[model samples]
Target: MKKIIAYNMLMVALFTPICCAQDIARIVEDVGKSVVVVIGFNVDSTANKLGSGCFINNKGVILTNAHVIDSCLSLQIELTDTIIEVAANSNGLFCTTRKTIKIYLTKCS
Candidate 1:
């Protein structure tokens, strides 16, 4: 009985990561729609830099790093289903939506 219990514990420990991974995968798949790629555009409409953001209130509020749009004249949000370009207002370290909103690219830092 002791040996059986030990074996069961070992099995659970080994499979725990796999189970967690699957759960994380499912969560990402479900919530990935809320994620967006924040693109900063210069005055000439040229892309400057890219950052990541997510919807805060589902009503067009986005939260992202301030540095992403520090010097940007405009902003564009790339979502899974659509892309939205709008004016942006940046404070010291926060972005507030003044208007209206990619895929699974496997690029890593």
Candidate 2:
């Protein structure tokens, strides 16, 4: 009985990390799909600031620091293959220049 218990414990210790590793990999892949690059530009088309953010929901809402989009006349959100441009309005609402696209999150190296 003692030998069997020791073997089982050893097996679990080795397999636990493997299972955890697989879970971590899947999570990274899933989150990577939502990562975005935020670029703020001035009225003259010069880049003002660059930051990173992720989509918090499916409704095209992004969660980022206020300083990322501060004092910019327009903003650009870069996804895997899409670039979304929006002008800064008085109400802080954004109007996309193109059709709506899905957002994904990612982990940056």
Candidate 3:
């Protein structure tokens, strides 16, 4: 019936956010091992603090903010689990790597 369809649509809409959030959480978790937290500044003297990055390729490619790296020529990736650091660099935007990693955190944001 039309009423039933409408009710179902409403229910789905209400739960869509939860589903999307879960999906994002999964992505975050899956990439947490390859992701890193970055902090730096921008050219305009603004405090561009606190950001995150993830790897998407097997060649140690990393993605993050140009501003967060303070526009530096190179970068450093810190893994959450192994607590290891890797030297890297970015070309103004996003990095790439295919490595899967586990992120350890008391809270996720």
Best model per TM-score: 2
Model 3, span 1-109: residue lDDT tens: 9999999999999999999999999998886667666544444544445577776565555566544565433333455754332223333432434255422211112
- Candidate 1 lDDT by residue in tens digits, 1-109: 9999999999999999999999999999988978889887777989997999887675666677776776677777787977766664343222334334212111122
Q: Candidate 2 — worst ten consecutive residues by lDDT sum?
A: 100-109
Best candidate (score: lDDT): 2
* Candidate 2 lDDT, 1-109, residue by residue in tens: 9999999999999999999999999999899878889998987989988998888887766777778777777888988778887776675555553566643222222
In Å, residue 30's CA in model 2 sits off its true spot by 1.4
Candidate 3 has an lDDT of 0.53
Clashes of each: 1, 10, 9
Error of 2 at 29 (Å): 1.5
Better of 1 and 2 by TM-score: 2
lDDT of 2 at 69: 79
TM-score of each: 0.63, 0.78, 0.42
